[model samples]
Target: MSSSLLRRLSVGLAALTGLLGTSLIGIRAADAVTVPILVADVDSGKVIYAQAPTDPWYPASITKLMTTYVALDLVRQGKVSLDSMITISAAAAAEPPSKMGFKPGTQLTLDNALKIIMVKSANDIAYAIGENLGGSIDTFAAMMNETAVRIGMRDSHWYNPNGLPDPRQWTSARDMAVLARALIRDFPDSHDLFSISAIQFGRAVMPNHNGLLGRYPGTDGMKTGFICSGGFNVVATATRNGRRIVTIVMGQPSPRERDVKTADLFDYAFGQSAGWTSPTLEALPASALPAPPDMRPFVCGGKKPPAIEDGPGALSAPGSAAQLIGGSAANSPALALAAFSNPALRARSLPPRAPLQPIAVWIGRNPAEGQQILESQEAEQKAAAANTRAAKLEAAKAKRLAALEAAKQAREARAERAQAAREAAKEAAKTTAKPAPKLAAKAGRPLPHAASAYTAVETPSMPEAKPGKGLSKPAAKATAHKPAPAKAAPAKESTGKSAAKKPAAKKAAAEE
Candidate 1:
């Protein structure tokens, strides 16, 4: 690398290292020395000079920069016009200090509210502004966190509508510097609200808290802050010869020390060379801060509002711009009505203990008829349930009857099979019991014992077989033999003749 280029690179690195190390210094005493300071290049948005810039300290009133940013956005969208009236609630009037003493039921336009907020540092007005824009103080704090995320303000959190002494409500000087840059870029036309030195609201004179407006050369406006914990802190911005710079000093003993430290920053920034060596800080360039897309319908007082005249710094309500800018419609819906619930709705007009019925939905002429209708519906539902149970019971009874009948039929078939087997066994036993005759063994004389076995063995009469191709018919007597008279009669009658007739025929044939 060339010698000149290397020299430039080294200088840039040093500048970046110094900027990174800048932090707020914690003061042990209210009158401590070695106060904090930081000077940044506005065009490039880089810190040219810094001392104790990153130190942890309280923000006090300088926290209003973010408040102003949020309010200015509402103005740009026309949801809040400059002359629009804001009614003061009793709660808003109850805030502690740095306030506008508007009586209950008193009204002030948004135009004057911004002035009071900037100059007098009114706490109640800040809360009211937040409540108007964000519905309530708690919800407004959430919006603050969301805004911080969107703007890439990485290290800031908010807890209240006004910057009170919650540990959660702290921010860094560098973070404030980034906010100042955003205020100029985001709300350029409305940005002038920050530079106002004095504003008159009903004979009360309010002067701005920032000390740089008239004292420093080319210094217009920004903001300042103080707290017992933070000591004194200021975020000041100035322009000279078309170059602007923002300086932040936190944790000074007195207000006077904070201003002096900030002036030193300006001197060092103006003296520094134009070119930067650090790629991170050098890359930052001035561009239009993104306008919050608005999707709310333009309307006022129960009528379609007239088309708003577009200003040079025309801001689309969150929805309308998003549609044109390829932004997500799902994020911010089109609000045809008011964005928030009316605070007046929460305001009670009646006393706490009034005779009221919570259960009744609406009052009507015939209350008794309505009650009867409800009773009838209830009765119908009960009847339907009862009918369902009865039907189920009937179905179960039919199923049980079918099972019982099937079991009875099965038992009858088993009994018939058992009786048939028993009859066959009895017939086989009678045939086996008959003694077999033995042939005469003694040539001409039959042995008594052997003859007895062989003597005319009356073979047990076997049941007659049916006349089929393979089986011989049983003896004629076997056919006539009956186990019982009633059992044989049916067979004999079907065979062709009665037993008595057969016997008489046989006797007649013998006489012939």
Candidate 2:
């Protein structure tokens, strides 16, 4: 941010003139003079009569003055032609009442649309102009804020293009008065559009809603609006006799009261035309007024809206404020005015949205409030998780039971196969044993003689030994008949004969 812009924003501190002082201004005098009164000289931008000009107030329909000012600037730059046709969109068609009854497909020139906005306080028409010119309401609002800053409107902010009551939407009457002054000064040529007392657009004739224009003489044009939150608000100006003065009355109870008080103010201002001095105005003590309720800031578009640059010669536009919009050759003032008289059908656009900022949250008492909320959420999550786990466990148990049943069936099949295998083995063995004995019988039939001899040999016994001495008596007799040895007698035979003769002689002698 530039130091100058910072200095401008720092001016917000001056806004804290105390809500108590503000409350005192709302009290009416015996003459029914109530609330903040700010009377200003339009040419000099000097405060002639001020009670609480700085005190905050809802700007209401007075915001349209700025809208008109920006539109006229575009017209001056030739970006928007006065007769350019604006095709209303669904979003613009959907704005809450105070409308021109233009359906979604209805079309109007830029000039007529401004007429509707000024006379009818038509939100739909205002949105139509913004959307057509700036692309969207949000984008148009950004341009509005930037324009406000450039024109030195410090105590103001715009959230929407139309001045509908949004809690976040707020502007001070002083800032509004500044806007009205700028409109009159910047586009003297376009000022007649505001003073139009009646407008007839395609069979719809709506009288100008500003009562002051018709009731108060020399009251040429301005705007008036009322919302319950904003009360009765008006940005009124008149060129009377020779002097032009602008009056801003906000938060008044009703339109009749606001108009009547404004008339009284104009009378006072007109009376002071004779040699008014600064010291006399400063001698009046400072009077306070009731501050409007704080509008809680809200962001539209459900999110932070995008920012947009202004078009041409505007701060947000490309190059410098004096430069024409790119691709525009209509540079001469006469050519530009001709283009504005008959603009391209596509030039209407929306205001921009508020600038993005950090979201602010208020904290309450009880130090553990955030923690308690977190804990409660955690408990709920845990319970849900437990239920999920139990469901999974039951599914797993069912799967296990199915597997066990399958295993049992497999075991029975295996037992049946084993028993069949054992029976087959037994039958095979019996068949093989019968074949061996049959082969043996056939072999015996073929070798009958050798078989018989084998049988006789098998019958032969081992020889026994002969009996010894313990044999029978017939064996003993055979052993006694054995022959004896012969005598040796040759020599002895002759000797024996001789001896026998001698023995015979001796025996004869003995017998004698």
Candidate 3:
């Protein structure tokens, strides 16, 4: 063969080799990732790509999508309004975080609550919404299951409104894609709720966890979920050139992986020729759906799968690899043909993420009414706080009064004791100050006398005539009587001496 012919043959062989290698890589990549994934056309209900689509897996917070559907259905039926209030119950408030953390009896309008549920993935709000719409969580779950069956979700079950961990709660990627399609079809008016990137309430701003909403070009709305047993999952939708696609990726190793995989799927689906078709979602066989896999061992048990990326010379997509090969060889004809023919094979530049404009929803109230209610709630809270403060102050005042009264009684008691002590001392001193009893002198010897029994008397003096009368016969007696006068005079002198001694004795007793 001529040299030119040989060159052409070599080029053809290289292209073939590159194509085969790329196909093998894709197959290997698909098998290496055990996670369930599905991409479908929203308009025709045709599935573009599928891997274990019917396999059972934990739903996690994605269960809120169903909860939202049921709620929106109730709204359609006129059973509830967007502005209707949903009173948070203890059960709802008690749900785990990724929650609103509102207390029981805290009220939020359904409109605003739905925004929180979509953006925050608030478990508590989801439960509260279920209760509000269905009268109880159990009833709401029943409603969810009923709707799921009606919508042709054969491999799904719901045990709670929020997608919290529950062994009985599970769903398949195919089912989620079905639900996503139905949501767009059945509730086009409320479809924008899923597209919200963030919501604001007062100072708190909750951003949606659906990374694809902004990172992936053409992405509009959907949901994301994660739990140890469920791994990371997402149901994403995008619109490009008037054509829309829905993709579900479950059991991803990380949020980044899920987002990249979803973006790649969108690029692949959108780039396909109009004539390309696959099995309709409804016509897909469901013979041997796999049992739900427990991802806890791989996700939470610290055993992680190896990272997989398309090799150089392989097709690339947005948010993933740029080119299969690097350096000068990247411009090879075979690679260029593959990348140009297949959008997924080419690198893409996504635009900067647009600022999120969340739809505003409030409890059974318009914006004005909601504002009024908020102000009223604030006023009530302030009033309750003021009342509590007043009560505390009253109690403190009463305590102080009681203490003062107790102190006054103690002082009175102490004063009474002191007064009693003073009286006792005075009585003791009076007894101590009294005089002692006196003794009498008799015949030059001291004698003790009983004062109560003794009395003193005076004797009349005998005259000197008694001595003259004793000189005659009778006078002789008279003279004898004169001697009696001498005796009487001595008695008088003794009486005078006794009177002087009495004063001296009394003075000595007083001194004692």
Q: Arrange candidates by TM-score, highest first: which order?
A: 3, 2, 1
TM-score of 3: 0.60
lDDT of each: 0.55, 0.57, 0.68
Task: Give the clash total for candidate 2.
Answer: 27
Best by lDDT: 3
Q: Write the per-residue lDDT of candidate 1 for residues 347-444, one digit (tens) a residue.
A: 31222222211112101123354356446656987999999999999999998999999999999989999999999999999888967874234444
Give the per-residue lDDT digits (tens) of candidate 3, residues 60-132.
8888889989888889999999878899899988877777667688788887888888888888898899988
Q: Kindly list the per-residue Cα lDDT of model 2 for residues 1-512, writing each as its tens digit.
A: 78955554444222212211222332221212223456777876766666556544556566777777777778888998877767788888887767755568666667767877887677887888888888888888888889988987766778777677655566666777778888888888878777777665433456666667667777877887665445566778988767888888765543555666676667566544424453222233332322344211110112332221000101110110111011211122222222212211122222332222221111112225424644665698899999999999999999999999999999999999999999999999888875343212232243344332222111112224367634444443443332221322344453554455555545533543
Which candidate ranks first by TM-score, i.e. highest? Answer: 3
Q: What ordering of candidates by lDDT runs from best to worst?
A: 3, 2, 1
Given candidate 2, what's the lDDT at residue 66?
73
For each candidate in turn, the TM-score is: 0.48, 0.49, 0.60
Off by over 4 Å in 2: 1-34, 274-291, 294-512
Model 2, residue 231: displacement in angstroms?
0.3
Q: Which stretches of candidate 3 lie over 4 Å from their true place?
A: 1-33, 274-277, 287-290, 302-352, 361-364, 372-512
RMSD of 2: 30.6
